[model samples]
Every structure is written in C-alpha cells, then in structure tokens.
Target: MEGYAKLSSLISTDSEFAMYRKFGAQNTQSLLCYQAELISFGDDLQQLAASDRRSQDTDKRLHAENWYELSRVENGKDQQIKKFDKIRKDNCLIQQTAIAKLDRLAPYNLRNLRRWLTRSAFGSSFLYGLEARAWDEVYDHDLLAFPRSYAENDKDALPQLFLGPLLELFHNLIGRLYKKGTTKDTLSPEPLIRYYDSNILRVADILITIISSGLPIASITALNYINRTITRLVVVAVFTVTSSLFLTFLTSLRRTENFAVTAGFAAVQVVFVGTATGAGNGGLLRSDV
Candidate 1:
C-alpha cells in the first residue's frame, strides 16, 4: 500500500509527467487557435459573398423604384409643368419685392442697384433668404408631393441615413479581426460570424448607395471628357483645312507675274506659319484666324 502511494505521488509530481501534460495542453491550444483562424477567414469570405448578392438585389430594387418614380412623375407632367411656371412667376414677384425693399432700405440709384445685385448676398443666393413657409406657399399648393419628395429624399437622406451605419459596422468588423489576430487571447469566430450575418443587409445597402451615387458622377465626367475631345478635334480639323486652303492660294500666286503680290503672299505665309506653330500672340492667334 505504501509502495502504491509512492508510485502515485511520483506520477503526479514528476517534472517529466508534468511536462507531458503541459505539451498536450499547448498542442490543444494551438489547434484551437488554428481552427479559429480558419473559421474566421472562411466566415469572412462567406459573408462577403452573401453581401455581394444582397447588394445586387438592393440595386435592382433601387432601379425599380427609380423607374416607378420617373413614370409617376412623367404621368403628371402637365400639372407639374404648370406648377413650375406658377412657382417661377411667384419667385419673380418675390425677387421684385426684395429689390424694392433693398432700394427703400438704402435709397440706391440705378448704378448702385446694378452693383448691389451683382455683389449682394440676396442676388447670388438661391431662395434669397426665403422662408420655408413662403416656399411652401408658393410652390407646394395643389401639386402632387410624391415626385419632388421622392427625389429629394433619395438625394439627401439615403446616403447618410442608410449607408452611414453600414460603413461604421464594416469598420467595426475589420477592427475586430485585427484585434483577434493581434491579441494573445483565445477568441471564437462564431460570435463575429453571427454579428456579420445579422448586418449583411446593411452592408449591401451601403454598397448599393455608393454604386448608385458614383455611377452618375462617373458618367458625367466621361461625357465631359468626350465632349472636350470632340471640340478639340473639330478645332484642329478647321485649322488644318484653313491652313491648307491658304497654302494652296499662296502656291497659285507664286506663278503670278506680280513680284509685289508674290512677296506679300510670302510674308503672309511666314506670319501664318509662325502663328500656327505658337510663335506669335500665344495660342490665341490660331483662334483669331
């Protein structure tokens, strides 16, 4: 019995025995860490894929809504146009009133009025300090509110109210991953995955909003670039044609009997060449021609 107790104590307290157990624990912890990393990466990839799908669906929905709104607005075109005309008249009256009020306040002459209109905040401003109540009274009476409201809401509210939270959520997710990788603590990916799944729709909303907003700006920029390129090409073609005609005229005159005429033509050719090559009057000489 004493020998048995001694053997048990040796097995329990021996450094080698303790080391063996410690090695097993370490291996188990390492496995868990590896498992966590793999799971986190897989989950993140799956979430991203799911978010992309949701974004596509959201994009479709927004497109459908835009078409629907556009159609609705189009259907009421005559009434909306008439309402716009009325608003324009009202705005003119308001501007006249503002000008009169300013004149009364300052006793300005015609020249001063012209200067003030050019320099004053009222002339440069949209609505010109018009109150919301006044705007509503002038513009909103008997008009279908849906079209204007829809456009304004989509332009102003969707990006900030709808996408802002999703951006913050994505940032939080990235920070969580970074923290997990850098920290020494044993962390499970399950909770993070759950959180991502819950917020995937919000992420999709953000992506859709960004895509929609960016597309219009991108299209406009491309259109402007194309327009500028076309204008430059037209200008160059015109300049080339004109120069060719002038050179042909000069060539015809070279065979003429009049030496003075030939000499004058040569002088004009020199001036033309100099102007075309940007030697005189900067680049404006080409435009002058």
Candidate 2:
C-alpha cells in the first residue's frame, strides 16, 4: 500500500539507493577476494596437515617403534612423546578446525543469490539492504540473512548476504531505469533504505499493538450480530494465521515464538468474545423481566 510519486521525479532524487547500487559490485568483489583468501588459508592448512613431517606421522613412529629417541642423537626426538602425546592432540585439533572452516565455504551461485535478494527486498522494490560478508584473510565470518531466504540459511554474514544483493538489485532495477528516463526529474532520497531496520521495528511494534489489543475488540464488534460461537472462532483463527505470517516475514521469530505470540493474540480475542457475549445475554434476560 505504498503510494508512488511521479516516475521522473522518483528517478532523479533516489540517492541512497544509488549508493547501494554502486556498492553491490565492490562488496561482491571484496567478498569473493576475501573468500579466496580463506580458501588459500584452508588449503595451506591442509598442506601442513598433509606433510610427511606432520605431528601424526611422528606420533605413529614414536608409539609403534618407541622411536621417541632418534637413533641419531642430534635428531633430538622427544623421549616422552608417547607418554605425553600433546603433538597428536594439537594435530587432531588442527584437522578438525580446518574441516569446519572448509565446510562453511560453498560454491558461488549468482542465480540463487539473485532470487533470494529480490525476495528479501520485496520483489525488487529496493526496500532495505542486508549486512552480508562471509570472510576474509584476517577474519572468517558467519552469513546472516534474517527473514532468511532459501539459499541463505542460519549461516552467512554481512556485506555478502544483505548489503551485496540489496545494493545490486537496486542498481540493476532503479539505476538502469533511471538512466533511460528523462534527465529533468529524479527520485528523492529514499528513507526506506536509510532507516530500514528502525522502520521495520516501528511497524512491528504497531502491528503487535493492533494484534494484541485493537483486533480483539474490533473482531467482536464486527461479528456481534453473527452466530456467536462459530463466528468468533473463525475470526480468531484468521487473526492468528495472519499475524503469524506477518511476524514470520517481517521479523526473525522462530516458529515456536510465532506460535506463542499467536496463542496470546487468540486468547485475547476469545476473552473478548466470551465477555461481550455473556454481557449481551445477561442484558436480554433482564429485559425479559
């Protein structure tokens, strides 16, 4: 239900979206370059783990042949290597950690990414940007796609996940469209992109208030003349489902959390229906007297 201004004006004044549009490529490149570094690091770790002089190989020889002390005295083998076994523990830890880091790195899929980003930004309207960057040489990070898309699960980080697609989509759609449009008009600054999360939170708070308090009384009043029992149940059910979906899409609530909120919402509606119905019935009975 967003109203739109003149198309030419919109094209001219939209600056924040333009910034993000430009940011998409740089962020994607930065993300990829950073991933390349992580891959190189993991590969190097694998090489170190694979080398012949690795700790595990030393452990096997030391444990099997009791070669803790080398035949050549200058080799300076650890006489207590088998007894302490710290080297093997260190080697095991390295291998385990390397496997974990490698698993986080997935093959790049621009197609899936495009779909996800579009979906997150409300079918290419360019609502808000995400914060997604997977990793780099100095840091390995998790992917975070809230209201996560299909390709984006619990993993993924900023710049790569959110900001990347959000910006790219804006550029591809708004940026491209603006160029062909008349130069005399431009879209104004986009507050939606600038204060996206805050706007979402504010809307969420308002929705919560409506669902918890307003809807209950409204439903009762609307359905006051209907078959009290069946109509109230239907109204309550509809409110529950709609609110559940709203929370799911707009906020990052889990299924259980949504359920709890929905349950409370339904409870209020049920209480309103019962109390109002009872009061009406009592009034009618007194009138008969």
Candidate 3:
C-alpha cells in the first residue's frame, strides 16, 4: 500500500518512472564501438598533425609526412593554398560529424535489439546478463512485455484532441471482432476501462472550491475529505469489479486469496469514508442508540 501510494505520487511529479514502468524501450547502441571509432578518428588526425618530412625529426616524424597526401592533384601546384584549404575543410567536416555521432546517448545503450544481431558476428553479447559493467548488455526481460511505446500521444488532451485509453478500447474490440490472428501462441488482453486522473482531479478541485467558498471549511475539514472520497467513489467501484474479473480470468489463485484481495481493495475505500465520517457529524450518532 505504501509503495503504491509513492508510485502514484511519482507518476504525478515526474514522468520518468511512468516512462519506464508502462512503456517499451530498448538498448541498442554500442558504447564500445562508439569509443573505439572516436579513438580511431582522433588517432588518425593526431598522426597527420604530428607528421614531419625531411626525416630530420627522427622517430617523431609520423606517417613520413610527405606520404600523408599521396593523391594526385588535378590542376594545382604541388601544394596550393586553395587545394589544401578545401581538403582541410572536407576532412574537418567529416571528423566533426563523426564526433557528434559518437557523442550521442543512444550508442551507450548496449541492451537493445542490435545486441541480438551481434550474437553471431562479434560475440559481444556473450557478456549479456553479467551486470558487471555499465556498458555490458543485459537480458531484455524487463522490456519484452512492452514492445510498443506511447509518448505524448498517451496523455489525455483537453477539448477532445487525444483520447488514448478510450480509443484503445475500440482497438481492442475491433481486433477481437475481426479474428485477426490464426495462431494463439501469444496473449492479447482487453484492458480494463481506464480514465486518466486529470478530469477527476479537476472535478475534485472544483467541488472543494465550491464547498470552501460557501462555508467556513476549516470547521468542516472532515466533511471536505468525505466529499473528496465521494467524488472517487464510482472509480473505486469500477476497480473492484474489474479486478475481480481479471483475477479470476488470469490467475489460478484459490477463492480465499481472490476474495481477500478484492475485499481489501474495497475495504480501503470504505475505511477512508468511515474515518472521515467519524471525524465529522457528531450529531448523526447518539449515546441512546
């Protein structure tokens, strides 16, 4: 219960856990390749920069200097300013682009689908699931269940722009009606009808404003909480029924365990209502009764 409360709080504060918890992602980029390629590029540039001809510089003379640019010149002098400048510009552009690619964050994700393709060729995937290094690959267990992702499209849009969950209900219904697949190798669940919290939160806020504006709400603090609970009361009912149906459909749990979980969920809501009532409305109860 405590963990779930924290999770709900986290979902509202930062979309970070929401992305990881309810979406599919991958780790495909290779950090090793990125580092190696960047190093190779830098080494080549350094070797050219340090090159000196005449052989007078001893071993410090790299690439023989003269041999560094052995390509035949088209129509310029042995080394003209125009040709050299153009060549330098071209090489710098290429190198800069390569550096930018290497600096990208995607390449460091070694757990993506690219690792599977690498299993046969480079054997780099042998260290998968080792958990030794940050760059090391790991099993796709956490991500396999989420093969698809929803980004900004998943949020509820105001004024009827986006309706993610409501539309998903139709997609699920159509897929089943069409009998889309021939095989039953996998499972396709029809998710419970879900409504995002934005609307409910807005409604709750409006009700609080109305109650507080009309009365001295500090004296009726418990009443305010009770009103808030009543706003979500329908949602609690839906969750209880849906949870029971899904539990029976998916799990082999004995009846006792199922009843306990189902009842507990409802009881938590009722307990809140009862607590708020107990705090307020002393006149509703009598010692004579």
Candidate 4:
C-alpha cells in the first residue's frame, strides 16, 4: 500500500511525462513533431539556394553572349570602314596623279604651234595641212552627230577636235620623222628653211586665229591629204626634179637662140615645176615617183 501510493502521486503531478513514465509514448511523439518541422525548413532553404544559383548562371551566360555579339558587330563595322577609307585614298591618289601629269604637259603643248612655225618652210606647210585635215575630220564627225550646226559651230562641235585630232597630228608628224624608212637627217635643210621662211609663220598665225575663232578655214580640206605612204618621200624629190628640168629647158632655149621657142620652153618648165611642187607639198606625189 505504501509503494502504490507513491507511484500514483508522481503520475498525477507530471501530466506530460505521465505516459513516458509508464512507456515513453507522449515524449517520443513530441520529439518526432519537432524533427519533422526542422527537416521541412532545411529542405526549403536548399531549394531556395538551388533556384538562386540557376538564376545567377543564366544571367552570366546572357551577359557573356551579349558581349560576344557586340564585339563581333563592332569588328565587322571596323572592317567596312577600313575598306572604304582605303578606296577613298586610292581614288584621291589617282586624281592627284592625273592632275600633276596634265600640269607638266601644259607648257610643251602651248609652245608646239609656235615652235612648228619656226621649224622650216616644208615643216610649216606640212603641219598646216595636217592641222587643216584634222580640223575637217573633227568637223565632219561633229556635223554628223549634230547636223543643225555647221562645222564652224563651236556649241555643237565634238570635243575630239580640240583634244584628240590636234594632239594626234603632232604625235603622228613626230613619229613619221623617227620611223625606219625615212632618213630624216638626209633631207636638205635649205629647202625646208626656205619653205619655213615663206609660209610657216604666217600659216601658223592664221591657223591659230581660225582655231581660236572656231571657224573652219576654206583651205583646210585642200590641205588634208589622204593616207599615202609615197607622198612623204616626194618633197625633196620634187624640188630636185623641178630645178633640173628648169635648167635643162633653159639650156635648150639658149642653144636654139629662138625667143618664141625659149619662151615656150620656159612656160612649160614653169608649169611642170609648179604642178610638182604643189603635189609634193599637198602629199599627193606618188611614192614610186
């Protein structure tokens, strides 16, 4: 009775521990509940950390990709700019070179006509003929394209007249002197000098005025000879032939001692020489002659 009374008093005093005192049931239940709550909180924290890590990785990847793309675009643009700059520089250099060349040529070109006039009579006549022919060709070409204006009309004329034909004439004449078939040095300076004195300067001045006034000379077509190889070799030949013929005719007339015969022979010689000289100067003399 004394033991039973002690046990009953302990149980009544500790209600929470009453079951544990007998079998530990209530204490175990409370411990299990607290453990479950702790586990749930730990799992919640781990999931939150994992989600944060993934979000940071995605942001980093996006930033890196954007930087790479931006760099590529900038590089491409830089290449294009460099290409354009190089092209612009090349064009500028070409333009500058052309301008420099043109400037260097101006003085020589300006003096050509005057220089040719002073060269020799044959040279002057030949050059004058060449100039006239070139002008005619240019005029004809311009007239074909713009028929309303005459060849003398500057407004409708082709620029080729001023640029191409004039330039070509000088080039061709110089080239002819240097060519293999013609022994230019063998030519007697006397006839050329005489021809120059008689015709070259005046013709050059007249040509210059006509060209400046944009008028085609009436004599231009008469001067422009056709392409003939023999024509070039005949000038010196004609001069020699005419002098020989005149001397022979004079000797014959003096021997005959007849005034009428002498006059007739003289007239014949004059006609023949005049015709030969004209033909030679006009470049119409045959190469075989």
lDDT of each: 0.36, 0.47, 0.41, 0.36
Top candidate on TM-score is: 2
How do all models score by TM-score?
0.16, 0.38, 0.22, 0.16
- The per-candidate count of clashes, in order, stands at 0, 30, 2, 5
List model 4 lDDT by residue over 1-289, tens digit each: 2222432342343121122111124434654665575466556645544553465555433432354532344454533234334444544334333433321112222233234334443233343444434323233222111011212222111332333354446556773455343222323222211111123334444554654333222112222442242442353244334434433432333434445543553454345446655876667446656
> Can you write out model 1's per-residue Cα lDDT over 1-289, one digit (the tens) per residue?
2222432343343211111111233445665665575566566645544553465555433432354532344455533234334434534334333433321111112222223233322222122343312223233222121111122223233333332454446656675565433211122111211132225445545665665355434433433343344453444444444434433432333434345543453454334344444543465567787
Model 3: per-residue Cα lDDT over 229-263, one tens digit each? 56546655765676676456534557898899878
By the lDDT metric, which is better: model 1 or model 2? 2
Which window of 10 residues has the lowest lDDT sum in candidate 1? 14-23
What TM-score does structure 3 among the candidates reach?
0.22
TM-score of 1: 0.16
- Candidate 1 regions off by >4 Å? 1-193, 196-198, 228-289
Q: How would the candidate models be sorted by lDDT, starting from the highest?
A: 2, 3, 1, 4
RMSD (Å) per prediction:
37.1, 14.5, 19.5, 47.7
- Give Cα distance to truth, residue 33, candidate 3, Å: 1.8
Candidate 2 on 1-289: residue-level lDDT in tens?
2212432243234321211122334555665665575566566544533452445555433433444333333444434422234323434335333434433322232333334235533223333433332222222233211122323322323223333455456657775555443333323322222223333334445545665476556666766766567777787788778777766764566789888988887787778778878888999999999
| Model 2 CA deviation exceeding 4 Å by range | 1-76, 79-175, 179-227, 248-250
